[model samples]
Target: MLINELSKKTGLSIHTIRYYENLGMIKGLADEKVKSNNYKHYNNNTIERLEIIIEAREVGFTLAEIKKILTSWFETTESKPETLELFHAKIKEIDDKMRYFKQTKRLLEKVCEKIQNNE
Candidate 1:
């Protein structure tokens, strides 16, 4: 599929896809060229990678982390342990964040209730 098809499938704009490609989030895509009218073509693998990258970002994985995972997948070493460790760490981080947010929410609710009672 081409960039437009990828954009439709991934629900991301072509410009954003280009930006991701430039940012090294997704690799092996063609660079812009004056030839072929400056249009870029993408394969199914690229589309799949874009989907993974989008999901990873949504789950709070930075571009550098995603790039490391992708590179590991491409490298000679198997990445199962590394990927598992990364996900486990992310889970812990999210759990801590959730705990803090819950505490903050409770405090805010108490404050709001006191303000309402006073008014």
Candidate 2:
């Protein structure tokens, strides 16, 4: 389908989709048979890729990291050591962030209790 349909299907804005395209994360191909406008078409694979991209972003993956993961997972035959290392590092970062979040949550809870006590 066209970009508009792809946008509707992916729930992403046209600008964001274009940005991804520009970033080399996804690709849209123009129909060669048509001689008029260079309208780019997307397929089911594009939808699947966009879904992965959305999920990865939600999990705090940067675009570069997401692109690397996508390329490694989709375009390559075997998993690379670098990709494994990157994922391991990301896991460590997420663990550290989780601890920080827990600490912040506890601090907020204590502050709330103090406010309730008027202390």
Candidate 3:
């Protein structure tokens, strides 16, 4: 599919898709036979990759982190320790955030209880 079609399928704006392409996180190939226009074509793999990117972004992963994760999937020679360390750090961060959120929830509940009791 063309970039527009890919944008529609992925629910991402054309600029965001192009930004990802520019960042080397995704790519589209130009047809060799079609010389008149410079339209690029995307495949199912691109769609799957975009989906991963969307989910990762939603989970608070930086673009750089997402790129490295995707690269590690393709490049077996890449350093496993580095990727492992990144994941480990991310896990710690999320855990810390979860604890903080639980504390905040408790505080909020206490405030609500005080309000109800006119304290």
lDDT of 3 by residue, 6-36 (tens): 9999999999999999999999999999999
TM-scores of the models, in the order given: 0.80, 0.85, 0.85
Q: What's the CA RMSD for each of the models? A: 3.1, 1.8, 1.9
Mark the regions of model 2 whose C-alpha exceeds 4 Å error after superposition: 115-119
| Ranking, lDDT, top scorer first | 2, 3, 1
**Which residue pairs show collisions in model 1?**
none
Better of 1 and 2 by lDDT: 2
Count the clashes in each prediction. Answer: 0, 0, 0
Candidate 1, which segments miss by more than 4 Å at Cα? 27-36, 74-76
- Model 1, 117: alpha-carbon shift in Å? 2.9
The all-Cα superposition gives candidate 1 an RMSD in Å to the true structure of 3.1
